[model samples]
Target: MADEGRRDRCLAAHEAPPVPPEGPVTTRLPRRSFARSATEVAPELLGHILARRLPDGVVLRARIVETEAYDQNDPASHAYRGRTPRVRVMFGPPGHLYVYFTYGMHHCMNVVTGPVGTASAVLLRAAQPLEGMERMSIRRRTDRVRDLCRGPARLAQAFDVDRSLDGADLVRGSEIWIERGPGASAASIRRGPRVGIRVGTDLPWRFWIDGPWVSVSRPAAVLSPR
Candidate 1:
């Protein structure tokens, strides 16, 4: 209960802006954009909009604010041990959603990066609610708009993401896609160690925009201006 209270306080620290009348008019990122390494794609995803089209025709959108990179060679990556049934999608083509269940309760979403046959992905850590706030609020069980999509699990829950979305194509699929937005400036981007990983703890692969919407607390050693 103490942890829950702290989470609530952290979420309440930022006031959500008024919902925009309309979402930004932007184009979906091309498949080629995700063909590079996860480290390269992670930082670049900040400020982009992730759109989820529900079965009821309601579209939920969020601006990605935090991401962490993972490669098969990285000790912290699921695919580090080699190919397996669970990580087959990671070795597939780029620009696909790699949704996985964690802690037996939460589902985290990743964007497959790198070329075919390589296991590299970017974990979308947090996003700022954009379109469909009412739906997101209802799904998240919170009226505080800032709390709707503050963490990866929360973001997935708000968007109704689950194992069913695993391997969903983001570049060409209609259900889930990422659209270009006013990207975060390089100066505002910060890099630190990834969260909740026992291995690869020292690698500064986590990237996020310096903003209240970021999921985790600010790291003491922020390597930025890249």
Candidate 2:
């Protein structure tokens, strides 16, 4: 496995525009689409498009660039505590949002996966703004497009995702939804230890594109030993 240094290194430059989706613009990914376990879904999330439609019909979209997986057996996962009120969504029918307020301030989001009673999810880490840059910047209070959604909390802020969106169906496009975008092969993806966790920190569950400027700036050094 690549060490932390290599895992956290910046990827090669990718300056090209997003490749057109393979089929008709995806409106919503199906419920069964995310029935796989979190580890299996995390890497596959890269290059997908996440969108949220506003009251005025404004649709904001960002291309997912990074993600991390968590499951019930993982000590760091919320579900490890076993079916608490806030974590109940993680045991789901899949393709639903599992949002939580963290640090008593910022909100982070995850896509529920696995079986109905299996708690597993993929935390969206960063994304490349694909549409509605102006609103995203306004919401994020930053003019730097690159920083709009460069972290889990930041992604939630930029997309206006919060507790209100918890358990929202992603397979339905009425509000928030994930659409199929381009797919990246294993050669184009990299894995790393999960971030900002004191437990299960050694699990190499984090995945990201191997060559995309849109990814968050990797830490100068690994924060924890893996």
Best by lDDT: 1
lDDT of 1 by residue, 56-118 (tens): 769999999999999999999999999998899999999999988999899999999999999
Per-residue alpha-carbon lDDT of model 2 for 56-167, expressed as tens digits? 6688998888899999999999999899999988997899899999888899999999999999999999898989999999989999987898888888998887676677
TM-score of each: 0.86, 0.83
Model 2 residue runs over 4 Å out of place are 1-27, 211-226
Give all candidate RMSDs, comma-separated: 9.5, 11.8
Find the candidate with the highest TM-score and give its number.
1
lDDT on C-alpha atoms for all candidate structures: 0.84, 0.78
Candidate 2's displacement at residue 189, Å, is 0.3
Q: Model 1 reaches what TM-score against the true structure?
A: 0.86
